[model samples]
Target chain A: MITVSNLKKEYGTVQALKGISFSIAEGEFYGLLGPNGAGKTTTISIMSTILEPTAGEVNIAGYDLRTNPIECKKTIGVVPQEIALYNDMSAQDNLLFWGSLYGVSKGELIKRIDEILHLFGLHERKNDKVKTYSGGMKRRINIASALLHQPKVLFMDEPTVGIDPQSRNLIFEVVEKLHQSGMTIVYTTHYMEEAERFCNRIGVIDSGQIIAQGTLDELRKSSSIKETIAIAFANLTDELFQKISLAWPEVKRFDQTIHFFTSNSKNDLAKIILNSNELGLDIVNIEIMKVNLETIFLSLTGKQLRD
Target chain B: MFQLAFKDLKLFFTDRRAMLLTFLLPVTLITLFAFAFGGIGKAKNEVKEYDLPVCDLDLTEDSKTAIAALDTDKAVHVVMVTLEQAQEDVKKGNKDCVLIFHKGFADSLLYGSPLPVELQYDEAQEIQVSMLQRALFTTLAMVPYSNRNNAQRMLNKQFDKLIGGGNEQLKAQVHAQSDSLFKSVGKGVEANPKTSSSTKIAIGSDIKMTKLVEAKEENSPGLIQAVAGTAIMMLLFSVAAIGAGLLDEKQEGTLKKLLYSPMHPNNILFGKMITANSISILQLTVMFIYATVAFGLDIFSHVPSLVLMIVVTAYACSSFGVLLASFAKTRQQVQGFSTLIVLVMSCIGGSMIPIFIMPEFMQKIAVVSVNYWSIQGFYDIFWRTLPLTDTTFLTRILVLFVIGSSLNLVALRMFKKNILQIA
Candidate 1:
């Protein structure tokens, strides 16, 4: 469990975090979702004690981060966004080194390193230098190194960025398994689907403030935008697209697909089809989408998750 | 801390370029220096030989004796030639100087007149000119004084024998006549200004020219100096190379990962220092062993002093590297600053050149260079062959250790205050 209250961080004249507060209970998978430079990493950094807050307090597993940093650190593992590995060293060596730094005994560290390697599916290449590994393999080893100590809480910051799909799936499964095993995990990412799929509770942060924090359904109910009707058109002229936009004020165009935002999608879909037929445009495929994190983020920030 | 240091060493050893630079580069440089300086200190103290061209116009017994003296002198090689040839040789720079005895030089010496001589020399050859002047003076002094004294003694002995055989009255008359004749000759020689004194002056007895004992040819020339100089300089460079790993960790995000663990930032810095120190010692040890085996240097005779010097030097060099790393933000910045500091220290600290030969002001400035003190400590042990207990030697080693320790403390403070906080 982690508690971050009034967490504020300033880097010279720029404020990275501004009095954002949140807490995760034991065995909870909490996701901090935000766009780039939305203070997600800064929040995680302050809570993890990697970067000290300008004015705030963090408690990890009943230990205050400011007063008892070593105790707090001993209970947490951090997987940085970048590949923080000694390229010339083997995976086994990296694991052993990190384990020892956590004060694990020699025999236990060896056993833990083996288990972690196997868990990350990196046991086959454990003896090979990290520099010779592929991007996905390296990412796996990086995660494995963090898990060597078996800390109570794991903080993974954008771990799936730029990795192969298979590796990303493996990581997600590993994270899910760890959460099921009653471990507290704080995951920070911009991927809306990942947050929706893995996180038990999600915190939507923007511009150094947490705008929303709740479950998926709770977040959906809280947003003003409800559902989105997506229609794929085989042939839609510029005049027809303009006509559709004028007929429905909440409609937006994306390539060959036009999205119509409304509270009642079932009723809106019928009207859209009628208008399309009258305008001589063929509707190839139609989808009724519920309010998701992306829609909620777009409504709240007036921008996409990646922006 | 030890585990962290071990991990760092493992990484460095596996890096082939790092290993080569730490080990092979110093050995190669020392070998090149040994060959270039002709086996070390030998070149500076070599016995010098000068060539002297002699043109004796007098060609008398006295002039011949002077020429032979010039030839017999071990320092000079005398070449007999015509006056025209002698002048031409000196003018053409084929000879350092030409010694010419003018006509009547023998008469001038026999009559105790001024010795007529001309020394034609190349002005640019100052050392050779001074040597020739000294040799010429010695030769001229022997010729005039010995010949005149022998002539006077022989005449007196002949008069004594004549008086011993003849009657008393005849002996008395001969003695009176001889005394009167000698007195008149003495007055005449004194009244003649040119003959009053021989221009040839003997080197003063008080001057006491002591020849320096030749340096033993058995010791390898400049090898010890080369080893000491190269060791300190390369140690700084290699330690800096190792210290760059700190920046690497920072760039790769491993430093932040380490911070997330229970380990403190100071422990991280301490780990790096330990690794750098170990590698520095290893590098210097390799150099010493190679010097002893390849060049036959007697480095082991004073084992205690050598070990002390190595430890102190390694500590100072590694600490200096950490200090540089603390101030640098990037790997390139560390390289640039480390190189600038190491080269400046090497230049002033007697690594590239001996401190004894540097200008006095430069020598004073060299005190600020950590390399200067480290190399000087090595010199005390290796070159001077001083024992470790000697206060002068002990003080230098202690000062090096103290300075290194102090810098390390400051670097740790900086690491905690700036680098760790930034992360």
Candidate 2:
């Protein structure tokens, strides 16, 4: 178990973290959901031992971060938000380099590199430079480097930030597989759906504090809001959107002419239809959706997960 | 950490940028430098072959006088046993120039004018002919102002008017002074009439003069060692800036993976230092072998201690390069800073020029430069041949090692703190 009590960190005038606390257990796929500038990365960096906490008590796998940092670090793996790697070397070489750092012998490093390459379906292009690989291939290699040591806790900061759906699905599958295999994972990201599907528990952080924390279903059961409605409308006009925004004010985000949030779509449907008719707007599609991470984040923070 | 180092070593060779920055570029620069300073250290030691000719036709006093003048110059390299022999040999190209001082050279001088001797030479012997001409002019110019005919008549008139017959003592005294003036001109400037002559000859003085001449020639050979030493010194820095490889690692997230190991940051620093040091030493070793092969320098053979000194110097330079690279954010920045620092150190540290020749303030600055000690150590060992008994060589090596390792320690600490911050 990873336990933290009263974690506080500051960088000169900027108070990045103000007394935050959380915990993670083995086999738990925990997600940190927050908007930009939410201190998620800072927290993850400190937990990974890459950055030190100014004031905190973190016992990672029974090793204190302050006094037993080396031992604590040995139990963890980190996949940075940024692509930190040697671009000049091939994917196979980069993985081997990482494996060696953890004291893996040559034979073992070769074995791990081959296994990870096959597992990620990257064996064919293993010898190509990372810079030449597409965004997703590079991401796979980045995650593989973190997993080479097979640490007790794997901490990833925004693993699926920017990539195609195909690549995103691949990462989600591997992350789920690792969690199912009893590997503890601390995943931080701004994408609500990604977190909703993969995380066993999540913390919705805003402005350096955790506003809400629980399993996806538990957080979705926010006392303040219930249910949600998502609809895809063809040729949704600004006039209709303005009417909806002014009337409901809870349409968190609209993508491809569709708005989703934690608002009640049944009783509010009458008001939405009346406003749309007043504005003479046409509705092409509508659907009532189940409670999800998007609705939970919006209900708890009173703001969108990504502005 | 050792495993990380091995991987780094493997990856260093395969990584195009790292290989280019670390090995290829330094080798290129070393080749360029060797070519640029190509003729250095070579020009001074060349033993020029001078072809010379000598002609002596001396059956009379005047001919003997002229022959003595010709033989006076050490650089003349005279071959004068017979005029016919000189002409025949020079004509056959065995000599560079030949002289025929006319048979009446003494009578012409007595008649108050000198004869112009005939010189024969090839057009290709222009330099040799010119050298002889300069020497001839200098020797002839030292002859005392002569009015042989006028003075003789004046002397006869004096004898006719004053004494009617010669007074033996006065004639003897005049002859003595004239002979003194003659001997002075024939010998050297000491035959000068305007200067009083009181001379004593020290026995075996010419040997001392020969030694002094050799010493003067010794000072002119400084260029060879200076250019070579400085170029070799900067080569380490050019190689060590390969720390830019770290930036590549950081960008690819490989640095993150390396940092996840159970080892402390100090272990990583040691691995890097060893890598950098080994590369620098290898480069210097190759250059040393080249010098030995090309120049017959036997630099290693002459100075048994040079081997150890150069090793320490290379490590120091490369370690300092690591310290400079710790703060740079990118490969380009690391390269730029390394180049600037190496150039400044080489120029100011008496690598380009001798520190003793520079101004006092610059010399003081050189004391702080690692290259200064390195160059000094080399000079003390190689030039002076101080052997193993010299404490200076050992001290310089120790000091350089301490300075290098300390700087590397600081750089490693700085790297731990700031490497993560660069991105």
Predicted structure with the largest lDDT when compared to the true one: 1
Worst 10 residues of 1 chain A by lDDT: A296-305
Poorly placed runs, candidate 1 (over 4 Å): A232-253, A267-285, B1-221, B417-422
Over the stretch A1-307, how does candidate 1's per-residue lDDT look in tens digits? 7888998988889988889999999999999988999999888888778787899889899999999999988899899898988999999998888889889999999998888788889888899999999899899988888887788999999989999999999898888889899989899887888998999999989999998999988998888779998999998778888999889877777788988878888787788899889998988898989888888887777667888
The clash count of every prediction, one per candidate, is: 5, 7
| Chain A (alone) TM-scores for all candidate structures | 0.90, 0.88
- Tens-digit per-residue lDDT, A1-307, candidate 2: 8897888878897888888888888788898888888888888877877677889788999999988988888788888887766788899988887777787789888988898898888999999998898888888888998888878899988887788788788888888888888998898877777787788898878878877888866775663456666666665767667667877776754753545454466787676667767767667776777766776676667777776
- The candidate 2 chain B region of ten consecutive residues with least summed lDDT is B204-213
Best by TM-score: 1
lDDT of 1 by residue, B69-170 (tens): 667666677878898876655443345567788888777665545567777664434444665677667665565444445344434445667668657677
Per-residue error for B314 in candidate 1, Å, reads 0.5
Say what the RMSD of model 1 is.
14.0
Error of 2 at B262 (Å): 2.3
TM-score of 2: 0.68
lDDT of 2 at B388: 60
